[model samples]
Target chain A: MSAFKEFSKGIYAENPVFKQALGLCPTLAVSNSVENGLGMGLAATFVLVCSNVIISLIRKSVPPKIRIPIYIVVIATFVTMIDLSMAGFFPALHKSLGIFVPLIVVNCIILGRAEAYAGKNNAGLSFLDGLGMGIGFTLALMLLGVIRELLGNGSLFGLPMLGAHFEPVLIMILPPGAFLTIGFVLGFFNWLENRRQNN
Target chain B: MKDILKLSSILMLITTIAATALAAVYSVTKPRIELKKQEALNAAKSVALPGADLNAIYDVKGNDKVLYYSGYMDTTKSNLVGYAFLTSGRGYSSDIESIVGVDSTGNIIGIQVLSQTETPGLGTRIEEIRYGESLTWVQKQFIGKSAKNLAVDKDGGEIQSITGATISSRAVTNSIVAGYEDLLKQLKETN
Candidate 1:
């Protein structure tokens, strides 16, 4: 594949969240507000790109049977760095994100990409792949966050856009709200794909 | 045998690198993290007891998990505004922890849910207040109410429970009341 294609594929054609449906736990848990969505997305993105490059650079030396453990160790280090740094620099956001930060180690997106793409590709190509996948994941979370925040809290990015009279749909910000929003958004994407194929 | 040895060595090398990197990052960020934690406690103190001297806050050494901090007017510590303490108890999904501010008259000045693992929507509404927009937080129900009156309306008290989060609401009210009682006992002992 061309260099640009490698970077762009994860954005839409092979998007991790909407298209592939990978890493939904963190996506749904943190997408209730724009701030949380962006925080998680960027954090995951950092982990993804760094792990991809490191795994790719060392893939040749790593034996096939033990690759998974090596990949995990690398991904976990980056996740810890993000977790500790966020607590120090962005304490409030770090507190809100809570367990999800450490949980990033288990997020399938990071491990899956390291196994499938970075394990075989060159270091540069793998880095691009990671960037594409990370941005794609961030954008998807932001979209879900916008919808839920506006409906659930009558606000966008913590700003109360709706007047005082506006009563929010409480369910939209709850756990059930996470499932409902993702389901509808996924359905919309599927419908769009179907329409394009018909033409 | 040769392949096994190579595999083990490579894995060991990777693990070593990962550990070193983590240690480096942790050392750099440890002081900052501690500072942030102290700042959070300080910020919560200010919010719960506005205008109280940050320097005059002192730990009263509770017997249990409850944390009590006495805020004084000056260095002499003769005048006391009230007490701010942290209370944690079982809620619907997880432990509900709150920092409550009680005035000298035993009225709740303010209550801030410090940390909670309650369900995201219903039970988690305890910490859902807007700062300047409108104070609709579920915890605000306790503000200005006397410690004696800190029960859900269903129990014939002044506090209004969240519609679907009666358990979570009661958890908070009961904890605050417990903290208030403890505060009174400690204050009496000290004075």
Candidate 2:
């Protein structure tokens, strides 16, 4: 695949959240607000890109039998780094993101990318793949956040958008709301892909 | 046997590197993280006891794992203004931790949720700040209520539960009541 194709595929064609359905846990958990979505997205992206590059660099030396543990250690290091730095620098964001930050260590996208693409690809290509995938994940979370925050809170990014008269759906920001939103979004994307294929 | 040693060696090397990197990162961030936590506690203290002397606040460790802070009006520490303490209760998902301040009379001065992992949008609304308000609506509701009588309206108390978050609301209220009683008992024993 071309370099651009590798970088761009994660945004739409092979989105980690909407398209491929990887890392749905964090996506659904933090998509309650745009700020959270954005924070989580960027945090995950950093871990993904860094881990990808390092994993690709070490892939040749890694014994296949031990690669999974190596990958986990690498991923976990990045997660803890981000977690501590966030706690130090962005205390409010850290408090809000809470357990989800550490949970990113288990997020399938980072490991999946490291194992599948980065393991086989060059470091440079792996970096692009990680960036693309990270951006795709970020965008997907933001879309969910926008929808949920707007309908659920009658606000966008905590700013009142729908005014006082607008009663929020209430369910849109809850767990059920997350499932409902993701289902519709997944359906919509699938519909779009099907239409494109038909045409 | 040779391949096993090689694989084990590689795995060990990777983990050692990972551990070193994490240690470095932790060392760099530890002080800053502590500073942030201290700052948050300080902020919560001031908010919980509006106008209480930040410097004069001191902690009294009770026998039963209860620690409460006494806040005074000045550094001279002559005039006691209020008491602040950390309290927590089981919420829908996680423990709802809060710092509550009460005057010498046991009426709540103010409260600040130190941390909570409750359900977002519904239960987490406990931290939501309405327009043009500094204190969250939930925090404001606790002001001036007698800690002895603290309970959600669901349980026939005066405090109103956050809409759709009765559990979280009840958690905060019950925790405050329990903590306050503990504080009074501790204070009596110490005096």
Candidate 3:
């Protein structure tokens, strides 16, 4: 694939959340607010890009049999760095993100990219893949967040948008709301794809 | 056997590098993290005991489970604002942590739910304030009420549990009551 395509694939064709369905845990959990989704997206992206570059660099020496563990350790280290730095500098955001921040260590997206793409690709391509995937993931989460927040809280990013008269759909902010919103979004995307093919 | 040796050695090297990186990051971030935590706690204290003299605040040895801090208005100690303590209890899911402030008379000045993993929209309502002329705030319910008065209304106490979060509400109330009793015992001993 061309360099631009390598970087752009994750934005649509190989989208992490929507197309690949990776990292749904953080995608759903943190998508309650735009700020939260953005934070998680950027954090995951940082971990993804760093781990990808490192994993690609060392892939030549790493025996395939032990590659998984090494990738995990590398990904975990970056996750801890992000977690600690977030706690230190962005205490409030860190507190709000809570366990999800640390939980990123187990997010399959980072490790999946490391194993599937970075292990075989060159460093530059691996880096682009991570950047694209991370941005796609962040955008997906933000979309979910915007919809849920607007309907559930009648606000966007905690700012009142719908005004006082608008009674928020209380369910939209709850767990079930996440499932409902994601289900409809996936369905809409599928329908659009099908229509395009039919045309 | 030769291949296994190579694999194990490579893995070890990777692990060592990761460990070193993490240790370095921890060293750089540790002090800053501690400072942030202290700042957050200080902010929570001021909110829980608004107007309490931050300079006069002192720590008291409590059962190791909970740390206690008391703040006074003046050096003479005539105006004792309240005692602030950290308390946690098993809620519907995760442990609900709260900072509770109580005056010398054992009346709660205020309580703030510092952190919780309760179910959103339901159990999370413990942190919500209902809108109306009467003004019903869940955590604020305990404010000005004594430990003896701290039970769910369903249990014949003043507190009205959140409709779908009775367990969480009860957990917070019980934790506060327990902390209050402990504080009272300590105050008596000090006196």
Candidate 4:
């Protein structure tokens, strides 16, 4: 596969949230606002790319029996680093994200990428893969965020867009809204994929 | 047996490296993080007791822990404005923590939710500021409310609970009330 193919696949065909269904916890929890969704996406992407590169570099030396533990340690170190830096630098975003920042350590997307792609591919390819996946994840969250924030709050990125007359759909920003939005988006994507395959 | 030792040793080495890296990051970020936390607390205090001198505020310790803060109108520390305290209560999901300021008469002056892990949309609306408003609706409701009238409307009190978030609203109200009562008892004992 070309370098571009390796990177582009994660954005559409194998999106972590929509297609693979990985890391939905943060996706659902923080996708209510564009700012939060973007922050979470970038934070997770940083961890994912960093961990993927390190994991790829160390893959040759890692014994299969102990690779999982090693991968977790690497992934955890990056997660904690991001968590602390975010708390120190962006306290407001840190407060908004709350526990989800630390919970990124448990996000299966990073681990899955480490185990499946990084462990097999070279560091260069792994970097591209991680970047693609992170962007894909970030985009998915932002899409959901845009939908939720617009409908639920009648605003986009904290700015009022729909005006006073638009009665905000109360459920769109709630927990059920996360599920409903993701369900429809997932269905739409699946339909798109089926059409592409049929053609 | 040899393979087990090798695997364990490798895992141990990886963890050690990870720990060391984390320690370095923690040290670098610790001061800034502490500063940010202090800054947040100071900001919340100012909001809770508007015009209270941040520098002049002093902690009232009980059981070797800070129970509340006594804010003064100025750095002279002569004129007492009110008391600001941190309190938390179990909400629908996580603890809803807030800083509440009450005047000398024990009527709340202002309040700010310091931290909460409530549901994102419904429960989290406790911090929501409606269009064109500065203070959140929940914070605005608490101003001038005394401990006696702190209960949410659902509980037959003056405070109106956020729609679809009665549990979280009640949690903040109840916790503030409890903390306020505790502060009064402590102040009386000290006097």
State the number of backbone clashes in model 1.
0
Off by over 4 Å in 2: B62-66, B132-134
Residue-level lDDT tens digits of model 1 in B1-191: 99899889988998898899999999999999999888877888867775578888777775754357877777689888778988877888778887887888987776788878665556767787653635657446877778755788888887788877888988988988888887778777767
Local distance difference test, each candidate:
0.86, 0.90, 0.83, 0.90
DockQ of each: 0.59, 0.70, 0.52, 0.62
How good is the docking of model 2, as DockQ?
0.70
As for lDDT, the candidate ahead, 1 or 2, is 2
True contacts kept of each: 0.74, 0.85, 0.74, 0.79
Candidate 3 residue pairs in backbone clash: none
Most accurate candidate by DockQ: 2
| Ordering by DockQ | 2, 4, 1, 3
TM-score of 3: 0.89
Q: Model 4, A83-113: lDDT tens per residue? A: 9999899988898898899999999999999
The candidate with the higher DockQ, 1 or 3, is 1
Candidate 3 docking class: medium
Error of 2 at B46 (Å): 1.2
Per-structure clash totals for the candidates: 0, 0, 0, 0
What would you estimate as the lDDT of candidate 4?
0.90
Model 3: residues >4 Å from true position, as ranges?
A96-98, B62-67, B120-122, B128-139, B160-164
TM-score of each: 0.91, 0.94, 0.89, 0.92
**Cα-based RMSD of the predictions, in order?**
2.5, 1.9, 2.9, 2.1
Off by over 4 Å in 1: B62-67, B117-125, B128-140, B188-191
lDDT of 4 by residue, B70-169 (tens): 9998888889999888889999988888999899898888899888867665787798887778879666888877865578898888888988889999
